[model samples]
Target: MSFIRLATPLRSAVPRTAYRRLSTQTTPEKKSNNTALYFLGAGIAGISGYIYLTGSATAKVKATNTESPLDPKSFKDFKLKEIIPYNHNTARFVFELPNNEAALLPVASCLVVRSPEDLPEDDPRALKDSKGKPVIRPYTPVSQPDEPGVLTLLVKKYDNGVASKYIHELKVGDKLAFKGPLPKYLYKANEFEEVALIGGGSGITPLYQILTHALPDPANKTKFTLIFANLTEEDILLREEFDDLKKKYSDKFDVVYALDKPKEDWKGETGHLTGEVLKKYLAKPELGEKVKVFICGPPGQVNAIAGKKDGYQQGPLGGILKELGYKEDQVYKF
Candidate 1:
């Protein structure tokens, strides 16, 4: 049989569970005192009472916090509520929010996440990069912006990934500090006649966020096409959700998938995304600013499609998109 060596596993586009241990050391008097304090605080709040069972387990936000729990300026610690294994190296992490409120993030934004500050310096869970600076990563949330009580992230594990490994080992109720709905491209309904989202592996989250927010709105008249690439059939993330979108909004949405290796029965496009595939699938430059192409993936894929991002700058547009007659203004690199 002919064989194709696997490509380097896609670096998660900068993107787990365990059980928390309970202590049995509390004396009855301490417990009574804690319980009294909890109820006293709840009574003080009246209708908007605090209902968290474990004191100090959840992030502290203002008691009058409203609309969203995320603060762009400051880090807040949120407890892990659940973990669901999605594939061999991917999972969905659900984090608890204060008082059962929605994350309320704006469309096409992300959260900056890092290990809790309290971890000891030598602890394995404390993640640091090469310079020993605390490692922080941006993740696009998988749940809807208005999804209440929790925020969800779809994360793919990379072998040398410090953040992924730290997250995978966490037990339920463990905390991670998070900040921001750091804005990406501000997407608005009907602004574009057609939008093309090209993503690979874990990069799908941001594209998914844009679609979920836009497609269901009664005011939406925009059309969307997603060209998602992956290593194998099983590597396709959010397949079910995309399929449902195709069904419900048949006129407004469609998806094309490219796989590096394919099963005998596979029917989608084969091989990595290329100028040819993009030429076939992406909206034409002739459509002007009314058409937007968004690309997000591993560095290799993003660089190939739209050129490397220069630090925080979008950098100069080059590569397949530029070669195919798309302008820098017509594309957004995520």
Candidate 2:
């Protein structure tokens, strides 16, 4: 949001007297001095030109180096920089970027990650899966798209979950192969009057990505309502960040946390998110295209809410959202 303005350099001017002296001088000594002066001037001009060209080339190299580290077409290995524990099962993993640069990820996109052991045959020690393929999974980063120097992923360890377990076990200096900027639905300001984000567990991340990208824009007029379901209060990921957003963008954003098993002092809803619960908070289906619903979570939760995703494609509408009269186009599964 800030810009640096470079001041223009002042051009040096030659004295009229110096030109007159050169024109009037007839002595060989004066002519020789003038010739020496001309040579000196040429040398200075050559040095200046060389410096300018070198500086321009340096600037171009710097620009190229600052480009986003993740490539959409190929997998690149990024070394782990730091890890911060979030809860009993979840942690935030930070990976170093080669140069100081932002992730520059598009809004609502994710990266595909796989273990280094799953890399190509060039590595003699590479491990092969029993299924004869690498275990790859897509994950949305909780960090902002423009966060520089590193990209961070909020991961939760799931029992027998290959990708999650691998991420959880990563040490600070280890590396992971990542490929993406995998495009999802790119949101524009005021594209919809209302957006209902329904998610469970780590599913809140993509929803978080959307809201963070949207609400911060001065032109954003859309209202967002998030219904996040978790096992308990402790299971809610990015709770503080969402709460801060609600406080800062009160008119444009709000969130409802649903805990399956809440503590005695908890005041939020305590039950699995159901169709009835959704109906109460979501925009009326009659609003049609003005309203949009996004669903992401564990397979069961997503299926119960808006039907299962058929691999990379969205499956048929068959769940609570369908019963509630939400059309296929009005809902998206991530």
Candidate 3:
């Protein structure tokens, strides 16, 4: 029942639905129509017939002075090299950086993707207060950060998901504004004796990022146990990749699958992550911070992990973590 303050990124990384908007101030009316306004995700790049964006939602990048070419502050334009369809609702966006760009992707970072064009007027995801703004979303890359030459995102398409839908519709060769190496978590080798990775659906991306970084390093003996939840067999993403990693690092990694709608032959656990389920799978709190838990999923799952109304302000922890006697620092919500 102890309440501990969560980290800044963990508190702010709450999944924002497309319809939720940031607090916006009204722009002053200008008599001229051709005036250029600068905002995150507001720049455009004209391709052969289609146009993609080449701007950052975090800040405007100056080509003259940049800390590093790969830095998010130095937002760079990339071209979509390939699209691999994973299932009916998800596609992998493989974007390629210039040959000279930094290929090492920092562990557990993200990218801000902005569509060049705004959605139709009647679309629910279209900007409400900031009508002139384009749709954007933060996504974790599926490709290992150091995997040279390309950037890949395993995105799940939602009917009303603005960025996800737009990305799903993109063809190979289309370009988009990709600005980031937005580091969410700073991980060290064997920082924790044991860690639990809990994720659902598309939230599995970050968990995968951490998995790839930790399991393969022979120097890092951090043991990982992942509990991934999905609606059905079709919704389970990166199954092959996770399986491969588990086999490669047999002693260090293990994965558990949870399904909501199982077929007749389904043989694993099912339903949402209840306290009892967590008690059985999650590491006990005896070692304090030495044992850690990371969670990423839709709103409901995040709320359950971080606590209902318990973020930034350091409110009391709730849900399974609270029920399990885990401290706030011991659990991170992504």
Candidate 4:
């Protein structure tokens, strides 16, 4: 609701500076073996996480529902209500919902977006081909369903990405086709005595959803630890909010950062997500279902921790978890 609502697409979004390979075919969406989104970062004032939706105990009960927001096969049109630029590559896209219905979602779910091929084309993006067939991009909702009138997505822009490119090109008042709050994971109150979320980049969105949802539930006593990995200190997302969570709920929540590059002042772990970090931060696997591990992020991290993807199915739990004696059911990929 605090975002900028424009009547037309901003010319700034169009690439005025010439770049190579503008006409190359858009790549298909990769099937992630990565666990449903779960990651963390640190920040202080005005964190970008607020650009999505930061939760509180008071706003908790409003966004609960288990139905699909829209039919996946049949697209429902939603209007672009606002656009909030979070950083260089990420933006908070706000869309108006059709009505006052339940937000049609469960914990850790996503919807697909498609561009209309019927629009006047000044420059063709990857969303549709000449034949008008649309490519779908699945994105998890960052806004709580209780946030009235609008659904929010924290989008990370990509140069050759069909859906991201199409979404980036959209202006105010543009209608986008969306469908499904396809449930990825059904989380219950204190299903696990402890949950460890491992993620990086945008993968943290789903983890954020689960964290916010759990903290509000009086029945959920699940302690949480977040291990977020990124290239540099600046790359860490939602740092301040995570810090605030840890500060306020220090008894229940903990966060760890593993940056590939760190400054002199850096205090947390610095390296790839390896077994040592897992052993130090993650709850011991001996607890079984009382402790569950969730991972999401780069294919390398996912592949390393949970093995690769055979299409959408996880290949094997063959990395740090396996070395540490964690079983398949004990871990899940997003």
lDDT of 1 by residue, 4-24 (tens): 111111111112011111124
* Model 2 RMSD vs true structure: 11.3
lDDT of each: 0.84, 0.83, 0.73, 0.74
TM-score between candidate 3 and the true structure? 0.73
> What TM-score against the true fold does each predicted structure earn?
0.79, 0.78, 0.73, 0.75
- Candidate 2 per-residue C-alpha lDDT over 132-216 given as tens digits, one digit per residue, 9 for 90 to 100: 5566789999887776678899999998777788788789998888899899887777879999999899888899999889988
Top of the candidates by lDDT = 1
**How many pairs in model 1 have backbone atoms within 3 A of each other, for residues 3 or more apart or on separate chains, i.e. clashes?**
1
Model 1 residue 231 distance off true place after TM-score fit, in angstroms: 0.5
- Among all candidates shown, the one with the greatest TM-score: 1
Ranking by lDDT: 1, 2, 4, 3
lDDT of 4 by residue, 13-81 (tens): 446442223333253122111111111122212235554566632344353444545675676878888
Q: Per-residue lDDT of 1-334 in model 3, one digit per residue for the tens?
A: 1112212333345455411422231432441122223211122221211322434334333233223345586545678999888898888888886653444657777877774333354555443234555655788888766555677889898876767767777788776676777877888889999999999989999999999888878798888999999999999999999989889988888888999999989998888878878778888988897998888888787787657544434455677787779987887776
Off by over 4 Å in 2: 1-66, 117-132
Ranking by TM-score: 1, 2, 4, 3
lDDT (C-alpha) at residue 52 in model 2: 93
> Model 3, poorest ten-residue lDDT window?
40-49
lDDT of 1: 0.84
